[model samples]
Target chain A: MLDAKGLMVFYENMLALNNVNILCKENQIVGVFGANSAGKSTLMYTLSGIMEDIKKKEEMAGGERITVSGKIQYKGIDITKLRPSERARRGLILCPERRRIFKESSVLENLRIGGYLASPAQANKTLDYVFKLFPALVKLKKRVGGFLSGGEQQMLAIGRALMAQPKLLLLDEPLLGLSPLMQAILIRATKVIRDEQQISILVTEQYARPVLPIVDHAFILENGAAVMEGSRDELLNNPDVRGAYFGV
Target chain B: MEILIYGTINSIALALMALGFALVYGISRIPNFAHGAIYVVAGFITWTFLKVVGLGYFLSALIAILVTGILGALIYRFMLIRVRGMAISEIIASYAIGLAILEGLRWGGFKGMTYTLPVFIAGSVTLGGVPVDIHRLLLIGIGVAVIALLWLFTHYTRIGLALRGMAQDERAALMLGIDSDRMALLATAFGSMLAGLAAIVLLPLGNIVVEAGYNVLILAIAVCIVGGLGSWMGAVLAAFLIGFAQILTVVYLGSHYQMVVALLAIIFTLIMRPSGLFGRQKELEERV
Candidate 1:
């Protein structure tokens, strides 16, 4: 299980996330829906330790400029202050929104490099599984990553993350700019990965409609706050959420 | 025929000099302007060692190379790393070091005297009816041999491959868990050693002075710009091209304008081919 409680984040002096709490059960797909500039990227970057500004509610300093803060517990261990690579070692992997792929390198080479922070023996075992999960990537393994289409790049990104044998994969805005066909492919693939690998996934998305059915639970964020969080069915049925977020 | 043979030897020597700086730039991503100081320092130090301490020529050269390596490492870890990512600042830093080193060498030990080295060989070689100093010819041979070895190292060795990877993309290299600092130290040592070797060889043929590197430094930098960073093959080719051009210029227009032509060629190459003739193509890889 993953739990984040009483988390506060500040950058300089401004608050991005304030006193937020979350719980994700093992092997579950959790989604966070938010508008642009709603502090989604900051939240994800904080979780990954790339942007380090955590705060306890007691320590909040009229906070408005700081980034991510809060207790993020994974498997009962507090990972709030862990280094990014240390987090990866403990199976808290991030597919980073832009998918930092090494261009001029082949798809397989990029994947192998991503697995660098892992043990070679384990990475090799997981490499076969990653290929099986994203067979499209397997065919393009020898091709340079820079030449891949957006969808293919996204597949390679997630495939690289999975190559690390992640227990909880944090994806930031996975479907933000992808085409409808690509979005569908990603959703279907993400579902299969969760079920087959028994890995938990927390994906952020701007369009909730497409992401609604696949995820078990969700939190709707607006203006840097989690307005509501519940089972997917509840969020689907809520009139306020539908009117405000889904534009129903 | 006389001009052609002399020009070839001169070109090869200048090419070897440029390789010294190119090696450091290719690995560390810092345009090391202070490398001229290495050439001048090694030359002066070797002259002093063999003349004052009565050491053999080769032994003095070895000592100078070892000292230069230590200095190179010190400059890297203490100075270059501290001010990297600020290109303008780094340029200023290297120039300051160069100016300080040049001036320091003048006052402290050399005392503005024109120091001459014992000739490595007395005879001249008559090649194609052109008589050239045998020692100068020997320096040209050594330059080619060193360039060949450097080529083999980059194309085949593990550390050389890592240096290339770092030069192309430092962040990506780090993502691969390569400790770039260690690689950098090794590169500085290797580059300084090569430069020192060139200095030791060239010192015997030319007058040794505190500011000895000024002429050769410009030649080397031009070679690097023309060769392209991160490309050893490019360096070798550019070195020869610039070298021969310098000699030919001296033959036709005299040595007074040799540097002017090299600079003009460098500027022309910069405008015409920013990546140089053999430079690696920039990969527009997305990094978001």
Candidate 2:
């Protein structure tokens, strides 16, 4: 389980995330819904400790001044100050937005790269599990990552994350630019991964209709704040939530 | 037949010289300007170990390579780590380190044409009715083996896979628990070892002079620039192109014009295609 309290991120004079609190219980699929520029990705980055890397790079380049204030606890350990790789070592893996797969590498290479943290046997087992979860990847083993279709790339991205043997997986915009059918397949696979692997998932999305039915608990983010948090049925009953996110 | 054989040898030699520079740049985006210094220093170290310390050639070469690798890692840890992400600072710091080492060696009395490594083997062989030294043939064999080994290592080994991941996407690699700093350190060390490998093999062909340090740096940069800064395959291809051109210039225009070929290749590549032949970053961007 992961607990984050009073998360605030500032980019220069602009507020990217403001006083947001989120939690993920063990083996649960938690969804964070938000529209464009709603701090969805920022929250994910902050929680996964990638914001620290961005902050360092920006500081080095004399670019934008990014200030992040948050206390994140993963399995009873304070991890807000930990580096991204350290956080990943503790099983907090983020499958970033835009499917940042190694483009020049082959599909198998991407998956192997993702297995950097795994033991040899664990990597082998996960390799099997990944290929089993996304059968399309098996045939595209030799194909370069960039050449894959959007859906395939997304699958490879998720598969790559799985290779890290994560306890909690962060899915950022996994359905972006994906077709309805592909979305359904991915969503189904997400659920199957949770049930089989018993890994907690914190998935973020702009549109909530497709993802709503699968999430155990969901938080609706608006303008960098968590405006609503409820169980699946509780959120579905809320008229405002239905109107804004479900397009009702 | 002479041209063909010598051209292949020259090409592989150029590839050997540039591989280290290309690798360090490719993985960490740190233009290791100390590459030539490492090469020259390794040659000197090998000479010291062999001549002064009275060690065997093989042991001296191995020890020299290990020392060079540590030196490179220390340079990264002490100097390059601070200036990382700033391109100009990175270049200045590394080139400064290179200058200090090369000049320091020159000042330290590590000079003269007498300092030379013996050839790995003695005598020449008749290949296509042309006499080629056994050492040159051995260099070609080692070069090919090194490339093949590197290919296998990157594809099959865990650390190698992690390095390849970091080369493509640093942040993404971080997300998967591949430490960027650790990978960079590994890259620098491995690159230094490669430079040492090149030195031990090629320095035997000529004297280990301080001037060769500056010349090696220029030649390495030219090959890397013409090949594509971070592309290993591009480096090999560009090496062949530039290497053969250099050989042709040496045969026709005189030996003095050889260096001009590499310089010309760099300038031509810059004017025609700034990204070089195998610069996948820009091409990948256009694709996506």
Candidate 3:
């Protein structure tokens, strides 16, 4: 239940995303595939309202200005310019890349913050559900996040986001720097969340093969534009996509 | 006998002072250099309202704590939270506020002068064969009582737990729906209030000069470090250690290098533990 129309984003002077649009159905998983410098993260940042675009001529022309013009709607609520915390409270949670975990904090403490948007009762329920999906998190509750291994950290990061009880979860490269087994484990958790809670997700990935099988729809982005968009089967059969993206 | 009593009293009061500084540092994650200034002004306020304005000591302490709280909120809302920039800017703002208070109070007649206590609690009592000033014994008792209360507040209160949580992870705290700005304000005020209590107790012991703030400030820093930066018990324990050290050193080695020795203790702790006695090992990455 999310819609993006005519989304444009630029980082300072560099154009990172242009004229992008996508729709996410309820309970569906949408995968966006792109290479490095393909403006994937830029689009996500603009949609998430973390970056702001300056409108002055000096900034827009040549200065380091992230100029963004977009209309991002979640469940018909216009959140194109809402603050990050407000957006989170409205259930648009980000499981950011590079694992933005509070390393010095304990695992349970990290999860407790995820419930920022939920009611006290809802927070308790969300914590229980997250613990179930990532059972390893429960045993290591007292341990600091910095001390946890890579796989455990990733799981904790994802679990922390889930505590927010988001309506449309945004995942930025969940597979980055993780082993195949860890990747599979996280990928499985994504499916479980969608199945059990009916929450939609928009996930961006650098590699397609590992993520696309579970995705209901796929968008192949090239250079700052959406070059391809189709259902899972259509994307799988497209010769151009297979050659350019899959290298098959 | 006097030396022993002096050392015990000074140890407790000094610990209380350091606890205030450590509390702000631990929760706000900023040194809040203005904290000493806050303590200084709290002393002035206590004297002003208690003596000049003819209010009783108890009432003056109450108003001083409230004013300190408001001062903290002003720093947080107008300066710390709203004026967004690096932490250096925030610290500069706090220092500026402290300077402004110092200037304002001086302009209003303080003039780099010292304060006098109208009431005095003079007399002596012997503790286990040691003769001690009654007021100082009261100071030690007050210190212990305040420490117990603060320990309970931090351990049992919901907001206190949230503050501890915020200190560890601000974003996570925000995610948990914790009101961070409010928490910061409360912690800042509560911390300064402890310094005010210490100041209140220290009255009648001597005159409180405008420049007298840093002497206690230095010891508080030492206590925080030896106690482990934000560790409550650590600050308390370190306070006692530093207090006893100051007493023992002054008696044996003379009083000249007491400040120097305290500074050395801070340096040694930094080189050795870096995290303070109870402070957690900080993460390598700068917070996002």
Name the best candidate (by lDDT).
2
What are the per-model numbers of colliding residue pairs?
Answer: 14, 0, 10
Whole-model alpha-carbon lDDT for candidate 2: 0.94
lDDT of 1 by residue, A56-159 (tens): 21233333444555688889998888756566677777777766565655787767666655567877877887788777887898997778888888988888
Q: Which stretches of candidate 2 lie over 4 Å from their true place?
A: none
Best by TM-score: 2
> Which scores greater on DockQ, model 1 or model 2?
2
Per-residue accuracy of model 1 over B1-288 as CA lDDT, tens digit each: 766677667777777788878888877766777888888888877888898999998899889999988888887888876666556777788778877888887777674556888777789877777777789888878888888888777644546655655665554444334446666777877887888888888878768876566777788888888888656678878877876787788888888987787799789989999877666546354232
The Cα RMSD in angstroms, rounded to one decimal, for candidate 3 relative to the true structure is 4.6
TM-score of each candidate structure, all chains considered together? 0.71, 0.99, 0.82
Q: Residue A4 in model 3: shift from native, Å? A: 2.9
**Candidate 3 lDDT over residue span B37-112, tens digit each:** 7777877888889778998878988888778777766776777664322457666877777777766766777744
Error in Å for residue B8 of model 3 = 6.4
Docking class of 1: incorrect
Q: Distance (Å) between predicted and true CA of B209, model 1?
A: 4.1
lDDT of model 3, residue B162: 68
